[model samples]
Target chain A: MMLEFIQHLVNGLSLGSIYALIALGYTMVFGVLQLINFAHGDVYMLGAYIGMYTAHFFQLGQNSSVLALIFTITVSMITCAVVGFLIEKFAYRPLRKSPRINVLITAIGVSLFLEFSGQLLFGPDPKFFPQIFKPSGDWSIGELKINPLQILVFFISIILMSVLQTIIFKTRLGRAMRAVSFNHDLASLMGIPTHRIISYTFMLGSGLAGAAGVLVGLTYPKIDPLMGTMPGLKAFVAAVLGGIGNITGAVIGAMTLGLAEEFLVGYWAPTYRDALAFGILILILLFKPTGLFGVKQTEKV
Target chain B: MKLLFSSNSRHGIASLRNWILALVLIWMAHFFVADEIDPYFFSIIMYAGINIILAVSLNVVNGFSGQFSMGHAGFMSVGGYISAFATTQLETIYPEWFAHSFLMSLFFIFILVLAGLGAGFVGILVGLPSLRLKGDYLAIVTLGFGEIIRVFILNIDTIGGARGLPNIPALSSFGLLYSWVVITIFCIWRLVNSAQGRDFLAVREDEIAAEAMGVNTTQAKVRAFVVGAFFAGVAGALFAHYLRYLNPQTFDFNRSFEIIIMVVLGGMGSLTGSVLAAVFLTAIREALRSLQELTRIDFRMIIYSLMLILLMLTRPNGLLGTRELIDFIPNGSRKKKKSLESHP
Candidate 1:
């Protein structure tokens, strides 16, 4: 029983890290722009597809696996960032002055566009990603056995999270993004091109989403256009659960949600797992409208 | 007090003429469009009318009332399944008692309306808890409620669960569907023109100000949500009877988003716009299906998405916004007066 519990914990952490990555993308964008980038999930989907193509192109199934994996990840991230940038430049930037609802609609439109476009381009079949890494070490400590891949996923995710946090708090671009998110008008007044900052934020978020997509692909070994839908929604829930604008809160929320989902599926029927996440979201909203860490903003009449 | 129709009596008269013309055109289209109309086409048209009802009703809450509800499909599914069960089961159990055609149809419509009321009751139940919350929060709650309903339906095996309820009798005909569509449209038009609708508008425009003016914002919101759910329920009943099959997947978030797209594209807050947009969108979707078969290109949905994005960027208020056809009609005397004033 203890061994099984430990296994579940490792599995949960692996999944939790992916959710945290996606949730950070969501929370960061919401923090800066106050606009929900509904297409973020589609970007993740595209990333996975791009990775699949790269893996196939290089014949990585029989070739040098590590180099192929690195190439796939790099290409996927770049492609996703480019798409995210274009979407912001054309669809969102034009409507920045419009009502928030209009922007919301545009976001939904972009999401739908990406989903269907991906479907059209990739055909509605789930493609298998080449297994680039085989678990090298199976360590048994007491009753628990740990796989190398799980540890790798955890370490990579932690490194990415730390890198993101450092960029947001330490770098000049990150400072500009923070300033823009706080008050776009003030940021613009201070001569910080707000539009450029917004674009960069979207690119960064999409890049993170791309990395998460690649990790998810490696773990699940399946890529489909619709695969991102559920993960994206769960990540959004995680963002909200953590207080939408707080990056650390998003990570915490994602971990909590991931663990909750795993335990629920393990203890109960798997069918109820997605519903469980939504239920948690409803409960959280009922009690704490600002989320676990979100600052409450009062509307002025 | 003047009657609700008095303020815009002249515009009403002109609108009555236009509505009559539109009705005539619809009848003509129904009659002359085909040499031998298949039952399939009739059913599709009937479903289209039902979709119009749902889309328009949703417009009342999401568009006019300025609420973002992604749960209209939940109310629709509730109404559809309940009404289907009622009409079919009650008919089968007591065939001898309800043998009369008129009585049976009346019973069916009655049960359907009651089902809609039940859906409205559920809507109120959902609405009351989160009516005080802000827009995004309310959106999340309603979305959660929608998913919960779907999950509950999926779990209830007695109602057929995930496989869905099937073998329902075809109760709606072309005439019946068209008539209901007319009645629903008229009812919505009247409601929007009434003082109640003004309160709804006030709430939409500025909630705090509306409350300050004694609008009872909570009550107004509940009323809009309940009424919207009621009509959605009716639409669902029509859908169940028309399709003769019902599934939980039919009421998912995508379905709700489709209806929302219809409302947004039609111009939120415009009754005529909602109806027109629904018809246009349904037609476009049908056209796309045919195009897909011909070209072997499955990018129709992509086109739709692009269109939606383009529409938002160019005309965020939608094609019609709050303006009705009557507002644009050439009022010769008013035009002359305006010209005279400008010249002076």
Candidate 2:
């Protein structure tokens, strides 16, 4: 039982890392734009498709895992970044001055568009992602067995997250991002090119989502047009649970959510997984609306 | 307030004339177009009408009340399932005892309305917690409530669970559906124009100022939510009877989002806009289905996403914003500016 519990914990962490990556994208955009990018999930889905196609093109079935994984990641990230840029330039930029509700609807429209277009283009069948990485070894500590892929996901996620944190906190672009997030008007007044900053934010967020998609594809080895919907929703919930605009909060929230989901599925039933997530969201809202580590916003009349 | 629309009370006559003209046009369409419509198309129109009701009612809370509720479908599901269980089971258990069709249908409609009321009561319960929250926080709460409702429904065996309930008698038709539509429109229009409507507007505009001016912000929100939920319930009844199906998935977050999209695209507080947008969206969806066969491109949703993005970028206030068609008339000028200002 203890060994099974440890194995679940490892599995949960691996899943949580992907969720954290996706959640980070949501939190970053929300932090700066104050807009929920409803298309974020689709972007993630796009990432998986990109990675899968790229691997397939190279004929990297499951053998040349390292090279194929790297190639897929690079290709997916670039493609997703481009898509993200276009979405921002065309769909979101026009509605900047419009009511927030308008943007929200537009986001939904974009989401549907992605789903349907993907179905049309990709044929709606679940594409098998060519697993490049074969678990070379497994380590067992007591009853808990640590798979190589699980370790790979954890290490890659940590490295990427650490790098991302540094860029957001320690760099000039990060300061500009922070400046704009606090007050776009003020940031512009202070000579920050608000549009450029927002574009960068979108790029960064989409890139992260793309990377997450690659990881998720590797883990699940299945990609479908509609695959992004659940993960996207779960990531959104994670972002909110961690506080909408806080990056660290997103990571923590995703991990917690992942662990909770795993435990619930293990103890209760698989069907209740989503319900459990929503239940936790309600509980969090009831007690801490700002989310864990989120700053409470005061409305200016 | 009366003086705002009255030019020494003479202009009131002209405004009333315009209102009557608009009503006549709608009535004419109802009588002439509805009568000649094919049964299949008529059923679709009836469904559209129900959707219009749901979208418009949700707009009251979301658009006019300035609250983002992604849980309208939850209220709808509650109303639908409850009414279905009541009308179907009661009739099934004792068919001969209550054998009168007209009377039975009327009784069922009453029970459906009461079921809506119960859903409204649940809306109040949900809305209460949301009173303290704002924007995205409130959105999540409502979303959570919607999901919880779906999950609970899935677990409840009495309502047929995931398999869904069937064999519901159709209670809506061209005549009955239109009657309800007209009544709903009238009541909603009246409500939006009344003192309560102004309070709702005030709350939407600036809750702090409204509260400062003696408007009970909480009460106003609750009222809007309850009223919205009531209509959503009624729409659910229409759905239940028309489709003769009820499932937990039918009321999930996606359904909630669909209704929200209609409300948003329709111009928020504009009642006429919601109705028109609902029709437009339904028509577009149907058109897309046909187009898919010819184009071999399943990217219809992609086009929708592109359209949404473009719409937001180009016209964030939606297709109509808050302006009704009447507001564009030459002599229908009195309250036009005010309506626009209050809409988005």
Q: Could you say which candidate leads in TM-score?
A: 1
Candidate of highest lDDT = 2
lDDT of 1 by residue, A137-230 (tens): 5878976789767777778788888999999999999999999888999999999999999999999889888988888888898888878877
Candidate 2 off by > 4 Å: A136-147, B1-37, B97-99, B292-300, B331-344
Candidate 2, position A287, lDDT: 89
DockQ of each: 0.45, 0.52
Interface RMSD of candidate number 2? 2.8
Which ten-residue region of model 2 chain A has the weakest summed lDDT?
A: A60-69
- Using DockQ as the measure, the top candidate is 2
Q: Model 2 in CAPRI terms: which quality?
A: medium
Off by over 4 Å in 1: A64-67, A136-147, B1-36, B95-101, B291-298, B331-344
